[model samples]
Target: MKIGLVLPVVVQHPSTRAEWERTAGIAEVAQIAAAADRLGYHHVAASEHVAVPREIAVERGGTYWDPLSTLGFLAARTRRIRLATQVLVLGYHHPLEIAKRYGTLDQVSGGRIVLGLGVGSLREEFDLLGAPFEDRGARADDAIRALRASLSDPAPSYDGPFYSYDGFVVEPHAAQVRVPLWMGGRTRRSLRRATEFGDGWVPFGLNVDELQAMLGTVDLPDGFELVLGSGRRLDPLGDPDATLRAVTRVREAGATVLGVSLVSTGAGHYCDQLHALRELTGQAGCTFDADPGHDRDD
Candidate 1:
């Protein structure tokens, strides 16, 4: 299976974030992104959150760097690694807004952008944004349809239940003919949404067996990607045998791509872990050379 990173220093959850990340800055983040790019990793992701309620902040942690700004900066630093918004809340913006913004990013990154989107769940934050939280699932479905029609078209138009628009030009739109849409959530309905409206599914908080069972029910289209990175932390540096087993299990569970979170002490060690995983995956007979621009020297 193809491998990518659950990029560090972007979003720090209270339960899983390492101690060193408390003081890590954008410099460290860029260093890790550069290292992953050089190592032929598939992609790197950042999440989005405008603001978190104080009460929820303790459990969720409030340090979320904006995905667009973070990914935009990383785009200029790296040559080929695809930049992903691990998930941009679909209810937070109009579909055309996403098309225009991330389309500009796609142009900047030479078509290396993946839009991982979701229907958000935080009611208080949704209230703060003045976004409708009640029908967000339905809103998200319509938004996906709108995105599919508008992402690559300069003069785009769409008519949907929640949104309808026409007679406008989105200059410098997405470079990709069909910019990939990856749906994110932890529900079977989320999987169904991905199957219907997206190119991939990136589910969170699910185990290998759960993933297997969920995937078994879906008729995943050809080349449909399942990006899995739930459960235990990977330690290719300290435990290659176990890491290999974990990866193998994910593959067996029908994961086309692996979103890896490695055990590390700091930035430099994180880069080391990235290299170790690359080497390990390479030696285990997974193909990285097939990725476009992987062999580029410049």
Candidate 2:
């Protein structure tokens, strides 16, 4: 099984200016990209959301940089870490645009890119963007399908309720024409859509029971995935045997990748995660060649 990191990038304010430093600052961000590459982590997943959720009002997401720009900078900084997206809501961007942006990042990063695509659930987000919420799911399908075709040479055309294009060309093409698209979410609605179209599934919040029920209901093929994470923190496993057993259960359910988002707020939180990372790696049989360190170094 492979492991990935979901770096902290949210709207909430950190308590101090130091903790408040944006993750995308050029020098600081480079350290993280390089660290992931050097440590042999498989992917550094990115996320996208435009509107900030506030009480009674929706607005353009503050504390944001364009994900494509940020990922591009990281691509330049790293040689090996795969740049995977956790979920890029499809209704917000066109297929051709995504193919252009990510394909460029893939070429720059030596083809280390995985596309995590999702039809978003937030109705407020759609309303703020002037998109009809009801049509967004179908729109997402159209965009992803079109993106798959456009990524290939002798590019394809698409016509749907949401969009239409004739003879689109995707440049800086990826090693794989269709980037491995991990579908987001695990609800039954999400599963049905994923089985029909996605390369894999990356999900959250479902418990062991919920996972089993979904498995019994869905006709999953080999290589189909259930990317798992939990609310619990991982402390370095003094007992590797028990750790392996827990991971194996998820693996038995067809998960090809398992990761944990070590929640953090300030510098103290970052310190706490170093131990968590060590524990997780040991359980997964991953080794960090160097002694674990608190700060990312340039």
Candidate 3:
């Protein structure tokens, strides 16, 4: 299974934050990504939130680095490591705008981009942005379809409930013919949406049994990826044996790629944890070698 890393600077939750993360910024993030690249990690991920309410921010840490901007910056700093948005809230922007931004990202990143999208859950943020919070699921569905149309063709066009355009050309098409679209969330609706419209399903907080049950309901094809993450806190400076066991269990449960978050450790220890993870996974010699062209049509 491939291993992916989630940069610690994007979100500052207690479980994932180290002491130094409080003051960490772009340089720290770049250092982490560069180390991951050197360590043979398949991808490095970041999260997104345009704006958060004070209450939610207090709980979830309001310092979310914009995924596109962060990833774009990291793209210049590293090679080979794929860049991903853990879950870009789709309801916040038009599909055409998303297609344009991410398509450019793909171009600059040399075809290494995974557009992980979600039907946003923050009601206040949606209200603040003037986007429909209640019907976001329906809107996300339309947005995905519209994005596929806009991202794939030079003269892309789409007529959907949320967006409509015809014969308009979106230039600098994504480096990959079809940028992988991974859906994030664990609900039945999310599973259905992923099966119908996504190239992969990225679920968090689901145990092995729950993951198995969820997989049974979806008709995931051979190339359809299941990207799993350790549900509990990952203490990279702690036990390597325990981390390996957890990773092994998820791999056995049918994960194609595993996301490792070195959140509890400072940026200085990222390389150490990455090396330990590589050795634990027995993939020390592995490379970021997935065929970008292999799964072009989702």
Candidate 4:
């Protein structure tokens, strides 16, 4: 199975800034990403949040650099690792702009981009963004349609509840006709969305046994892709065999990628996690799958 690393982008609090400083900017992430690429990691992903529950205004994350922008920086620094979002909330940005942002990034990355999408549940963020939170799932499905059309076809036009546009055509079409879309959620809603539209499904925090059970119950589409991301810090999961077993189980359940969040209980542990995945990916003989493309000239 393919293995990817997730970066830490949010700031927890002022008191924790020292720990956060280790990861908080483009330069740091670029350094980390370079290491991952050299070590043969398959992808790196980011997360977006306006405000989270019970988060102190200061402790909560800042408006922060956008994911695509950070990804663009990573693209410039590395050639191999795919850039992606764990889930970029579709409601935060208009579908056209969202498509444009990713299309542009794909161009920069030379088509190495995977888009993990979701209609988020953070009601407060919607209130702050002036986007209606109700029926966001319906809105999300429409966003997916708009994104797909924008990436493919010429003169894309659409009419929908949350958005509509006419005569839309994005320049510098991606090298890959479709950007791999992964639906994010652990619930039934997420699973169904994945089966129906996504090239893959990324669900976080579940152990292999649990994932196996979940797979047995869900009606997965044929050849569905699964990416089981580790929840929490990476220290406990470093044992090579346990990690192998988890990824093995996920593969049998249809995972194409396994996202491991390097947990640093102390300092300088990220490299260890990278090495661990490198070994795992090597052993698995995971084939190189080209991600959805972007315009090289854009």
Tens digits of per-residue lDDT for model 3 on 180-247?
Answer: 99999988788788888889999877777877887788688769888988765555458876776777
Q: 1-298, model 4: which lDDT tens digit per residue?
A: 7778777543233443346554556666676777777766778888777665556445655544567777888999988889988789988988777777777788878889999998888788899889879878898898887787676544667777767889657665555688888999877677778877788888765666766777777777766668876544344345777666655655676677777665553323555566566556567765433333420111
RMSD of 2: 4.7
Which segments of model 1 are wrong by more than 4 Å?
289-298
Where is model 4 more than 4 Å wrong at Cα?
9-24, 53-65, 205-214, 217-219, 235-242, 252-254, 265-269, 284-298
Q: Best candidate, lDDT-wise? A: 1
Q: Kindly report which residue pairs in candidate 1 clash with one another.
A: none
Candidate 3, which ten residues in sequence have the lowest lDDT sum? 289-298
TM-score of 1: 0.95
Rank order (by TM-score, best first):
1, 3, 4, 2
| Collision pairs in model 3 | none
Best by TM-score: 1
